[model samples]
Target: MPKRDRSKRTDPTAVMVRIVVADDGTLTVSVDGAPYLPPEFSPPWRRASFPAIVDAISQQTGRTLRVDVIETDGRTITDFYTPRTPRKAEPQTSAAESSVQAASAAEPAPAPRLMQFAGSGMIPGEEVAVAIIIAHAESGPDGIARTLIDSRYLEHSPTGEAVLLGRISATVCVGQPQ
Candidate 1:
């Protein structure tokens, strides 16, 4: 019998970069088959790898991505990092619908928590034009609609109302307080 060749053949479709989230919520990043941060590092160090890798992937992919985390029996895989479009606000949500959402809170796997980040405030830093997506909050029973925007990033409110993105409307407030 002929002896088999010892050299390993490389898989062409393999992704050299990997993002792993362990069952203990430990996030690890490996680049080109090397640990971006070693296993002996603290959680903080592990987390610090996120931004750098994200920036690199963003540069390569040319897309804004949301990290969807998955936790299985003994391992957590951050395999759901997909390009995502920002969500638009619905015109209204009935009180009954809110109650239903509250009722469905119990489950082994809950829905991923969604977050909105926006702001408007001046800084001494470099001035760069930024395109921001915002979701308008629902109006209160008082019929007063309020929109929350960060003052740090505050360029200005929309001059008039229109669908900002999808069904979401933009609420403009005049002369915001300091």
Candidate 2:
């Protein structure tokens, strides 16, 4: 008889949660591609706020989890969540020292404005779908903003094989404070 290895360590897999937010603010949650319903005590979750749903899942999982939130405007936001660590006690400081520190701290830099353009050669008067997606992530308390997405129809120039053009404007914030 063959003996099996007995000392292997295996970690639990993180849960995959997906939520879709309707225009009316209703949220539908699915865990691992299956519908998830909290206990009766947690009814009305479909209408619960976004932060509330995140908190509930974080608490229930008690470990790192992945979440994908689909907004009403067709934007999909993805984020990872881990249980929060206990906060450390702040050292005692004089009012004067605290005020000085506050005054010396640098202001957050302003977000930069940017423009993106895309062109494709197509038959005259031909219409096609165009999508521009922007995403960002950060390991800070004040996390990144919701992703930007522009989806629309683009028509080719009415004359010759001229290119169809589309432009998307966005603001990107970088180097945010912790």
Candidate 3:
């Protein structure tokens, strides 16, 4: 049997990724100048899914990687250093204790809701523009009734090196005649 050649592989540790946030808050991901789509998702990722996307990439690469995010204005919004380390797991509880706790704290689960995009490892006090998708009861220019929270600004945490936006929740009645 002939021995296989092993000198043609690229180094995985040197991978670099760039994520561009368009003016509309949609994401365009590229790896070494080639477009890259996440494992199962299609293009046009939203801001809300940024962290998860990067985390998955980091885990797959198995090495600390650098991620740069830029806005349409050509300014670098945030710098992310995604480590190969696994996410911290929640502490396990014994089955009996868990059942007892569940019995004592059981309550009706709330409806699923979307939260604003959040990021860590950003410069303190930096201002970030956030686009929040929402639903509305009245029809707007987009035809269907929608409550879009576009052009919202959020300040990075002064003491936490993180960026967070306030919560927003509302009921949207779509396809209902006005």
Candidate 4:
């Protein structure tokens, strides 16, 4: 009789935990950028802050974890890491190709100009769907005098053409390799 491979290692997978902390201290924890669970999972911490997550993960993985927070204009990027040895890559497409496939088409699509040409206003909430609304709609500035988006994003999308044609007058910079 053939023996079953009962080891959990047989179906090993990488878990990408993306934590987006809102300006208001609301945390969005996603596994591979999809909704996984709420921060309220912890009964101890005040609203399941970063330390709460670290506690949970430390208990589960038995490894020390560290998180780095960096503030970029209109965005907060966080990097999480541990001293544990990295997992083996799956036998499939490289990370670079797989990552871009979601952001763009298989064929290189023309970038957008003005970048939505989404002018401005604040929906001001946790839903990422707000971006979708901004993508399809343009608004007059709320007069807040703000540069809400990361400019390079506009230069690389179809919105770039719109920005150029409309004479939107926003700076779109292209970074040269060092």
Candidate 5:
């Protein structure tokens, strides 16, 4: 009888975790800096939330693991260390080419820009989504007050339900008034 490979039988620890907070309240967690994949088991590899996985590891290890949260633009984000070491990459494509590929892979097709607004006077959560939007716009210069809304946000707060519509007037001129 042939002996089985023992190395392949053990599950590996994650090396790094990347968390992204969209303009909306949707939080996405990726393992090993891999692209986000739906929570499924068929592929043998799937994306999972950092906190959930950490909790599981803690239970198994019988020790509490600490994670550091880094914030960029007022969002709570964190990364955890894993035992697995990443393999070195072979340079094949130029930076520009890689950028082009990333841009193309991001969206199959571009959609028209649409502006929508939503708000709630009282909510259970810390109102992270609302604060994120205002901070995003405020960080930029004038005339740049727009944010991309995802399907998840729309589903939670529909078009005209917990949202209100209003407009503000401003004037712009190239040169001094004559």
Candidate 6:
């Protein structure tokens, strides 16, 4: 019986290249990453290896790429290369417009009507003081109205039996439509 020859009979398909992509677009390669080509490789060998290279890089780097075949080692060996594309710039608004918008947003708006009141007394019957305040109304675009009102008072009472009352009144700044 004749002994089998294992050296020259090694399958070229047993050798394979695996590829992985880095987050920053770097690519890595390994033998077990892809299937090896058989000894009877064909003309479309480069095309077949192209997908494996892309898959390897994408898996490792986590980036999808439109891969193009740049060069190859020919025959039993395969080599692949990939280049990254630049990102598009975002649209920007003018500084003047932005500032105007910010200023308008920051300014507080007026209310339609506001009223405030306060009163104070000392020692019961001694004396009692009360005050009332009314704020005028303000109008914004589209007939929106707003206003604020405040009032305060102080008093001294000797008998400690004094009573105080306060009220707020508001007047319309803009006349109502007749």
TM-score of each: 0.28, 0.39, 0.44, 0.27, 0.24, 0.17
- Candidate 6 residue spans exceeding 4 A from truth: 1-56, 62-74, 83-86, 90-178
Tens-place lDDT digits, model 1, residues 85-165: 447987787999888877876545534333223223311111112235443343333323434445434445453222222
Best model number under TM-score: 3
What are the per-residue Cα lDDT tens digits for candidate 5 across 5-40?
A: 787554444334455544442455454455545457
Q: Supply the TM-score for candidate 2.
A: 0.39
Scored by lDDT, model 4 comes in at 0.39
TM-score of 5: 0.24
- Per-model RMSD to reference: 21.4, 14.6, 13.2, 15.7, 17.5, 34.7
Report backbone clashes per prediction. 10, 0, 0, 16, 1, 26
- Give per-residue CA lDDT, model 6, range 68-136, as digits (tens): 222222212234433345578867879998999899999896543423222222111111122122222
CA deviation > 4 Å runs, candidate 2: 1-12, 38-43, 46-48, 86-178
Report the lDDT tens digits of candidate 2 across residue range 77-151: 787887777689999999999898888776664565433333333211112222312322111112212222221
- Overall lDDT per candidate, in order of appearance: 0.41, 0.49, 0.49, 0.39, 0.37, 0.34
Report the lDDT tens digits of candidate 4 across residue range 30-139: 54456645346543222224544555654555444444332123444445545355589887877898888766765775553332233223322211111212422212
Sort order, lDDT high to low: 3, 2, 1, 4, 5, 6
TM-score, predicted candidate 6 vs. hidden true structure: 0.17
Report model 3's TM-score to 2 decimal places: 0.44
